[model samples]
Each structure stands twice: as C-alpha cells, then as structure tokens.
Target: MFVGAIEKVDQFTRPIHFIFRYYTGSDIVPGTATLFFVNEEGFAITCRHVARQILYANSIYENYLKFRGELRKFEKDPGFETQRTNLENKYKISAANPIRVLFNFIQCVSAYKAMTIHLHPTQDLAIIQFKEFESVQYQGYAQFLKDSRFAKQGRYLCRLGYPFPEFTNYQYNKVSGDIEWTKEGRSKTPSFPIDGIITRHIGEGSEITGIEMSTPGLRGQSGGPLFDPNGTIYGMQSATRHLHLGFDQVNREVVSDGQRRRVSNYPFLNVGQCVHVDVIKQFLREKKIKFYEQD
Candidate 1:
C-alpha cells in the first residue's frame, strides 16, 4: 500500500553513516541512522540521541588524539608500559570507550562546513541544519500531517530508514590508529520500509506526544519518518518498547529435526514508538524553522 509513498519519502530521507573503533580494539564498526529534510534550506530532523552522538564525535576523537600523543612521548622510556597504563587511566580510555567516531551525511547536501543542532529538552527529537553548503542534495522535503487527530488507532503507517549497516566505505587507518572514511568499496546502503498499524497513542498528562505502532522499529530507524500511504508524515520513529507477553516455557520437550530436545522459551512483543507530528510541528515553530503541512 505504500510503494509509491516510499518513493516520495525517499526523495528527502537520507542516512547518516558512521564508523567507530573502541579504545582497545583495532576493528572498525559501521552503523547508520536516518534523517529527513524539512525544508529546501538544508534543515532536517532526527532523534536527539543520534544528534548527540554526532555532536560528541569531535570531542571523543580529540581526546584519543591527546592520549596518543602522550603515549608517544613515553614510548622510548624504560617504563613505557606503565606510563601507557597511566595515560589510559587519565584519559578514561576503557576497552568499551570509543576512541574514534566519524560520520558522513549521505546525499543530504553537496558539502557542509558546519552543522547546527537544536535538541528538544524533554523529547527524543532534534533538528539539524547544514551550514555553508554549496547546494542541497535532497530532492524534496517532508509534508507533515496537519491534524494529528486523524492518526487514529488501527491506521496503518510505514517508516523508512537505513537499518542495515551494509555500506563499506570506511576503514581503520592502521598508520594513524583511527577510523576514517575511504573512497573504496560501497558508499551507499539501501533504505528499508516497514509498515504497521497504530496500536495506541502515548502521552504525558492529557497531551499526546507519541504514536505506538504494532511493529518494532529497527535500530538504525530511530530517526526515520512515519508516514501514511498518501506520503504525509505522521511522526518520526524514536525507539521501540518491548512488552513482556507473559508466555514463558521452562524446560519444555520439543521435537527438532526428528529428535527430541528440551527447550526454554520467553517471548516479548516489540513495538515502535514515534514522536508525534504535533510535537514535531510545535518544536519547528518554536525554532522558527520552515516546514510544510497537509490535511
């Protein structure tokens, strides 16, 4: 039902591709997040968590650079190993800490010298503005649903995002001990669309702030657009809530591959939670950002 809507949404929806490495690991990990253009002036919307990571990337990398420089100064000393450990502790560079994080906006703008971010105080929403860009690369912008009252329960909606980290245009620079974007390998990942019925409205007090869907939102879909078959955006996918279904089996015997085996099972219902259109519109208006709306 949303084949055409996906095409329309894809025109403005873009992926933020990221590569990172842990402080104690040599492997580079790739990930993705989604965002959609709200205007022709290079303004886009995404999850606040996603924007936070982007905002912290510089500091994280710079901290690692400082640690590396300090370690190099002690490399020729007899107490090199001990000094290395001290440096790690001073920098709080644990094994799980990310030492490098690099991200690129995929097909959103021609080139941007800087990015301006506005984060909503209480909601998982954020705005990203590309600055000093030669041109906007996204084809169109989001048209939000005018009246969110029409987004009733049982209404089916589709969300679009880049959930799979299938792109490989990144590598770990062995010389610099950092992760960097490369010109080789695949540079793009495919956008996925999932459809589900609105199960309920989520709210604080009497004001509805979110839409809960019957299906779960994928990991990289956190900032994606939720729209109807008409291509009108209703919300932005924020997170997923897992409901414990209370169906648990302990040591149940089951036949598998013509053999009997004991198994234990527990199931949970995963559902998508989205930031509602009303909240999105309100935040945009508060920031004096331009956006489109349709009934």
Candidate 2:
C-alpha cells in the first residue's frame, strides 16, 4: 500500500553511518541511524540520542590520543611494561569503553566544513544544521501532516530507515590504532520500511507527545521518518518499548523438526514509539528552522 510513498520518502531520508571500537579490541564495529531533511537549507531532524553520540565521538577519540601519547613517553624506559599497565589502569581502558568513534553523513551533503546540533530540552528530538556545504545531496524534504487529528488510532503508517548495517566503507588502521572510513568497500545500504497500525497515543500528563505503533521499531531505525500512505510525515521514530504479554511457559514440550523438545517461552510485544509531528513542528519553530506542512 505504501510502495510509492516509500520511494518519495527515500529522497529525503538518509542514513548516518558510524564506526567504533572498544579500547581493548582492535576490531571495528559499524552501525547506522536515520535522518531526514526538513528544508532546502541543509537542516535535518534526528533523535537526541543519535546527536549526543555524534557529539561524544570527539571526546572518545581525544582520550585515546592522550593515552597513546602517554604510553609513548614510557616506551624507552626499563620498566616499560609496568608503566604501560599503570597508564592503562589510569585511563580505565576496557571492553565496555569505546576508544574511538567516527561517523559520516551518507548522501546528505556533498561536503561540509562543520555542523551544528540543537537538542530538545525534554524531547528525544534534535535539529542538525550543515554549515558551508558545497551542495545538498538529498533530493526533497519532509512535508508534515498539518492537522494531527488526522493521525487517529487504527491508521496504518510506515517507517523508513537503514536497519541492516550492510555498508562496509570503513576499516581499522592497525598501525595507527585507529578506526577510519575508507574509500573502498560498499558505501550504500538498503533502506527498510515496516508498516503497522497506530496502537495508542503516548503523552505527558494530558498533553500528547508521542505515537505508539503496533510493530517494533528495529535496531538502527532510530531517528527514521514515520509517515502514511500519502507520504505525509506523522512523526520521527525514536525508540521501541517491549510490553510483557503475560504468557509464560516453563519447560513445555513442543514438536520441532519432527522431534519432541522442551522449551521455555516468555513472550513480549515490541511497539515503536515516535515523537509526534506536533512536537517536531514546535521544536523546529522554536529553533527558527524552516519546514513544510500539508493539510
């Protein structure tokens, strides 16, 4: 039902690809997040969590550099191994802590000198402004639904994002001990669209702030656009909530592959939670960003 709408949304919806590595590991891990253009001036919207990770990437890389510099100072000493261990302990480098984080805006801008991010004080929404860009790579922008009353429950909506990290345009620099984006390997990943009915409305007190969809928002779909069959954006996908169905089976016998087996099953329903279009519009207006709306 939304085949054409998905094509239209794909013009403005872009993936933000990221690569990171833990302090104790040399392997590079790649992931993705979504963002959509709101205007021709290079402004876009994404979840605050995504923006925060972009901002925190600098700190992670800098800390790693500092540790490397400190370790070099003790390389010539007779107790080099001891000093290395001491420094490692001092920096608290571990498997859980990332030593490097890097990201690139995929097909959104040709080139940019810098970018600015404005995070909502209370909402999961955020605004991004690309500065001094040579050209805009995205084809179109989002046209939000004007009247939110049209977004009633039982209406089916589709969300678009890059949930599978199929892109391989990144590598780990073993010599430099850094993870960097490379010119080789595949640079594009396919976008996925999932459709579901509006199950409920989420609110703070009496003011509605979010929409709950019956289907779960897959991983890497955060910050994706939520729209109807007409391609009118209703909200931005922020997160997913898992509801316990209260159907629990312990050590139950079941037939599988022509064999009998005992399995314990605990089921949960995952639902997508999106930031409402009204909240998105208000945030953009407060930031003096230009956007489009349709009746």
Candidate 3:
C-alpha cells in the first residue's frame, strides 16, 4: 500500500509525494490510495478513480477554491452588482472545459514529466505507467490466475490497502492560492487486510464479469489487489454495496425538540466488488503490457 500527494509549494515546482503524503510538520497521508506493482519496470495498477485524482486533483480543488472565493466576495459585498457578475462569468467559463483546467494544472504541478493512464473501457480497473522513472522496486509483485475456473463461490480471498488516513494534513493556503499538506501526521498503520468469501460471480452464466466478495470495500481499498491463499491475484477491489438496515432509535424529546430523529448508524454488509482478473488481462494484452499469470 502507498500514500502520498501531488504537492505544490510554488508556481515553478511541484513534486509528487509517493511514500507518504506529507512528513515534514506532521506525519500524514493525503489523497491516499492503495497501489501494487504489476511488473518490475515501475508499472502499477489502481482504480481508475484514484488515477483520476492523481492526475487531476489539483484542478478540481482549484476550481473549488475559485468558487468559494467568489462566494465569499458575494457575502462581503452583498450590494455590489459587479462582484456578482464577475462570479457568474467565472462559473460559465469554468464549466466549459474543466478537463483543460486539469491538464493545465498537471503541466504546472507534477514534477515528473509524463504519465500514461489506461482505463478499462467497461471495468473500474486502470493501468498506470510511469514513463520517466525506472528502477522502482516493491517488496513483491503479484501474478494473476490465468484460469477463470478458480473464481468460484465460497472461495476465500484477501485484499490489502491503506484504507483511510490515520491523520490528514490537508489544508488550503489562502495566501498562495494553493492546496497544501502540512508536513505532519502519520500514515495509516498496519496496512488493512480484508478477508472474505466469494459470494458469487458477476455477469450471466458462462460469461464471468466481476466478483462479489463478502467484505465491504472501504474507501482507501479502491484499486487494491485481491489475492487468494495460493498467491494468485484474482482481481482488484473496486466498490461496495451498502444495504441499509433499520433507522436509528433516538430520543427525540431530548436529542431534538420535536423532529424525526434517526441516527445514520445503519447495519451494512461489506459486499466488496472486484474487477475480474480476465478484464485486467484483456487490458494488458490490448496495451501490450507485460504481466505474469499462471498457465
């Protein structure tokens, strides 16, 4: 599991923080996502959503800041017609090409030169290639199970990830007009291990689509590798389903005046969704990326 951020201290320089999001003032992990090496040459796999953030988080965050600033201006000068007009115009322009903003931010920020991201057309899986960096090492890498017959119900599987940040140092610098992470806060300890049985296979009979595990896939676990006891990578943890239980029982008389009081503590089953390994294999073959799989 890896945690870090795309940090920007000034306009000319932005370094990609890999091992830890921030480690200066506080031990923290920002924009955390679990990633694993697919091959020896710095190629890795993660969820498409996480890759989206890694590539465009700053642009989205910057948009938020701009929107907030405009709103704040409106709050300060309620009768200023020009301020309202300016804010409205900003909104119109921003909505048109948000992706352009993201790529622009990437060019301005990311320390590394280039990155190639391949998103699975129909699946949540994604492949990330670090073109500039070489010699990146991991403790180990995973090889997928080539045969699809092993994806059976009641089969035990496990996944690993840095689910949630133990401590977050996310902060916005008002002066610099930039989002920054304090150099303090610790990464989530003991990389989470979620174990469960394969409840069933996704898709129609004889056409495997995905895998449903009996574990709720948490936020940070997205893009994590799912493996079995025999060291075969089965799939990638992608999502979870929240089956709501009954509402919470709370004393309305004491808790609130006379409103319907119901707590959000609903019992939810951990139904972890995983993208099948075959989907990943297809993607790799289409891209001609090298990977290991059992014959």
Highest TM-score: give the candidate number. Answer: 1
List RMSD in Å for every model shown: 2.0, 2.3, 9.2
Off by over 4 Å in 2: 68-92, 255-260
TM-score for candidate 3: 0.68
- Worst window of 10 by summed lDDT in candidate 3: 1-10
lDDT digits (tens) for residues 5-120 of candidate 3 = 11110111111222222212232234345666676655677778767766665665566567667678567675766775676576543433332221111121124467788877
Please provide the root mean square deviation of candidate 2 (C-alpha atoms, Å): 2.3
Considering lDDT, which of the candidate structures 1 and 2 is the better prediction for this target? 1
- Superposition TM-score, candidate 1 onto the true structure: 0.93
Which 10 consecutive residues of model 1 have the lowest summed lDDT? 171-180
* TM-score against truth, every candidate: 0.93, 0.92, 0.68
Estimate every model's Cα lDDT from 0 to 1.
0.94, 0.93, 0.62
TM-score preference between candidates 1 and 3, better one: 1
Show where candidate 3 strays beyond 4 Å: 1-31, 61-112, 167-174, 182-189, 204-206, 244-268
